[model samples]
Target: MTFDLIIALATACVAFVLSKRSVAHFPLWRAVVTPLASIIGSGFLLLGPILNIGYGGYAPLIMIALCFVAFLFGGVIRFNMAAGEQAIQNGDYGALAIRIETLSSWALAFAYIISVSYYLNLLGAFALSLTPFNSDLDAKLLTTGVFFIIVFVGWSRGFKSLEKMEYVSVSLKLAIIAGLLIGLMAHFGHRALDDALIFNPPKLDGWSALTLAFGLLITVQGFETSRYLGSEYDAQTRIKSMRLAQWLSTAIYLVYILLISYVFRPDQMSSSETGIINMMQIVAPILPFLLVAAALASQFSAAVADTSGSGGLFAQLSRNRITERQAYLLLAVIGVALTWSANIYAIVNYASRGFAIYYGLQAALGAVIAARQNTGWQRVGFYGLLATLGAVIALFGQPVE
Candidate 1:
């Protein structure tokens, strides 16, 4: 009860602070991904699975690479905000978000399609974890439900519904995660740190390390969420939130990876979609129950939030004429279709490939624009190119078995 109270109060405080510093949709001190379930759903949960299978035990190396991914993400966010402002000043914000309208039209297609895939991943994982019914059946129902909800909410209430849901879900997720951390530390004691150090990775040299790290960069691409925050924040407020969110996300990533890597045996970690829950079980027998119950809320909130968000983005592409109801229907229809794949890893790998391609193009496009408009744009383009190359490696370099 005491711990729960502390968690609640702390989350409330963070939300309050974020709300105060917010402009447009950007909140001070809050990670933008927090608003949508995808941050943890896509990036955090997949970390263990991707590392265990793809990179083996060299996740720390990937995480180090992710730091740069984080920075590039920051720059992307800044660019969008700056671009939007520039457009607005020029009285051209009607298509400001579509700054490169034709190019962005394609970009939006790629992003929203990838987002649909991501939405299914979240919903599928949830069904795999909870309920006694068949995941296929459950997934279809959930997907359909999500689509209707998004359309209903989006048209009726607008993007604000997403921010509002984020306010609730993010607060809950942080509380639950903090509790998990405290539980792990309390039970394992400081000796767990020893586990992190025991796994010494083989040296691949600096250049090779960078190359391999670049391949893994796609895994950490979730932090630039602020870019979608146009009309939600002023430049000053957005920049502050952008930097803080990335650093905070990094900190969370480090603590979580260290926790899992140190506390559980390497072999015990399964590629089960709910692998995090499995890891918690090793920490304490009762943990799975606690975690499952907690994760239940986290998952549902996350699923609904993500489903709604993807719908919203698509609606934007349709020039709001597609209507929120239509977007929700679209999301549901897609999720039902994706639920056909029973294999989680295959779905995830494909989704990663898709997202990498999407971000790759966005960075490339952003870079081209920057080059013509700003000499510094070349660096952004190049960085994205390297990251895209790395993503290609993740797909092509390894057998992906």
Candidate 2:
């Protein structure tokens, strides 16, 4: 544990230095892709294991289903991206756009609250694991303080600052994930063939499977971060980057699930939120610290990015009546409240539902915009279909075990 703290603290110092250094301007890809740090953070570590915990050999099916819905969600965001750019460019957010933006902003803000809670819980778990003296309360308090500070600083400094640091955070996370995959493959060696063919029967019926798919929607929530990039980036770049992020995430998730599912029996992976840590611990003791550090870094980066996005949305929707700082302050307070009042899994449920609600609004707005632009019935029908799907998930998607 002492060694773990040393590694974590060293990692933190390196991150701090990276943040302080001058960063070059982002290219089109970098500009649009960096925000994905918010989406792909600790999620890469947790979501696959969570799916395995429930679906076992059937987890890949759920992953494919999730990828489909995520692409649909991406379509919803892409369709609406034009309207947002137009709103920014003309400084005339139409009545319908404003209404949609308002709804989406509020829903995303609530989702940010849940996300903050979940991030803090992950941080607390790490803190407790590393130190015998730290209680959950102590961990929460420490995390809450750090979270508020990051949100406030990021809001005051603006997206440009966040974008600058994003490359480091995103790279670190991706590297950690890649290293884990390599480590697992090396450890498995010839056992890979034996494990690859292992299968368990389906545990969920169709309705339950659908419910689980919707419930796991939070795993792809960050792709829509591109939706708000209009103020800083070109429309084409935003759309392209968003699609790239979605496809990239889908591929990464598929590989991650396959690798993890082979490592454990279906029943062996239960409902623990920290399944990644446990899995790593079983293979090699030193491995857990690396995963823990990655989780901490990823969660911190994600929380800051989302908090910044929510603050930007609130400031824009309010026409600057609420400054970004004030919006961030409000969000931080809400996040702190949610962190204290809710467990991590409950927060995950709320986060999933909140993003699902936002996706529904985006889909609805996409349909409306498609109608206005006379983009043809084909486009309209596609957007409408997505809207119906989002609405179904928003209204009836319950938390799945």
Candidate 3:
């Protein structure tokens, strides 16, 4: 009870600070919040158990590798924000660059469709997890309902009202997350003093491990949200905000994984989607409640953000031939189909591949623009390699078994 009180107080304090006028009104913080919210969204809830179960003691190392790869891809997006935007505005870009950027935008739209399904499905799972009706079919039905709700609200009243929920949801999620970290740290320290920490060996080796890591890219995939905010923010602000968001999320993820990796034996971890909830039950009685709240807020906010983004991209790409309402309807239809057709793990893999293809195209576009500007071959070559890596992830990333 004392620990729970401490956790609750910490969470409340963080929430209060984040809600302050000074912090909320800061321009860079506002810019940082959008991408930061997306980057840490549903992924934070899922990664702990998945990483520990899959990689065992090596989970923290794998987390670092994922963050590093995401950082590199973020660099590619940042480069395009500065160079690609200017070139397109001045007609300084070539036909191929234009085509690649267009294709990448399409890829991103499709990825958003899959990701919305992913987010809502997780939301449904978590929503039901603490109840008596926590079954797979029940979860999917709930997800389908939420999809309809989002589409209805979006088509009827517009997302203007719903969009206002982003700030509150993000603040709540971050506060709960800070509390989670505190609980995990205290648990970890207790085990350390007792010499109870376990360092289990990796469960899968070499090729299988590599493919699994690739499949998990969607966990770190949301930083590119900054690249597409060109309409709202200037290039420099978007670039800097993206870098800051990535850095903040990376730090959060690494610490969470490190504290979590050695705290439990491999045999105790659950492989189910809501495994983190059960794992946190062992950390603190209050943690499961806090985690579920964070999961719901983060997932709904992320789904709404991506749905809004996908609809706008569809309308923009169609040159306004397709209205945003029509796009929302289409996204709802596709998202419902995805919710019924495959499990969450399969959706995660599909989303990862979709984003990888988009990243690959963006990297290729970056390389082309660099070459056109007579930039050194070394920079172009690095972008080419990054493009190839993205392609590899798209082609080879596999679903968790």
The top-ranked prediction according to lDDT is 3
Q: Which is the leading candidate under TM-score?
A: 3
Clashes of 2: 0
**For residues 1-401, could you state the per-residue lDDT of candidate 1 as single tens digits?**
55444544554554465445353244464445443344454456556544544444566556656766656645654665565545633545344324544444344444444454545555555545645763656655665565555556656776667656656655566555665666555545655545443453333545554444444443455444555555566666666666666666677777766655544455667655667666766665555555554454455455555455455556666678876567666655665465564344444444455545545545554554555465684575575574475346445422123
List, in order, the clash count of every candidate structure.
9, 0, 0
Q: Compose the digit string of candidate 3's lDDT tens values, residues 1-401.
A: 99999999999999999999999988888888778877888778888888888888999999999999999999988888888575764557788888888899999999999999999999999999999999999999999999999899889877565566777888999999999999999999999999999997888889999999999999987888877677778889989999999999999999999999998977678888899988899999999999999998899878877887888889988999988899999999999999999999999999999999998988998898889888899989999999999999999999899
The root-mean-square deviation over C-alpha atoms between each candidate and the true structure, in angstroms, is 5.4, 4.4, 1.2
Residue-wise lDDT of candidate 2 within 1-401, one digit each (tens)? 55444444554554454344343233555754455676676667667677776677778777888878888878778867856656623536447765776787778767876776677677666655656645668777877887767776776687677665666666666656665665565556545755554566657767876776777777767888877776777888888888888777777777777766656766456566666777777655666777877777677777767876877877877788987788777877887887788767767778888888888887777777777778899887887788778778776665645
Q: Which structure is stronger by lDDT: 1 or 2?
A: 2
Say which prediction, candidate 1 or candidate 3, comes out ahead on TM-score.
Answer: 3
By TM-score rank, best first, the candidates go 3, 2, 1
Clashing pairs in 1: 23-232, 23-233, 24-232, 24-233, 25-232, 147-328, 151-324, 151-325, 215-390
Q: What is the lDDT for 27 in model 2?
A: 58
Query: Which lDDT value does model 3 have at 130?
Result: 97
Query: Local error of candidate 1 at 34, Å?
Result: 5.1
Compare candidates 1 and 3 on lDDT and give the better one: 3
Model 1, residue 263: C-alpha shift (Å): 3.4
Q: Mind sharing the TM-score for model 1? A: 0.74
TM-score for model 3?
0.98
Once fitted onto the true fold, the runs of candidate 1 whose alpha carbons sit more than 4 angstroms away are: 1-37, 53-56, 85-101, 116-124, 127-152, 187-219, 297-309, 373-400
Alpha carbon deviation, residue 340, candidate 3 (Å): 0.7
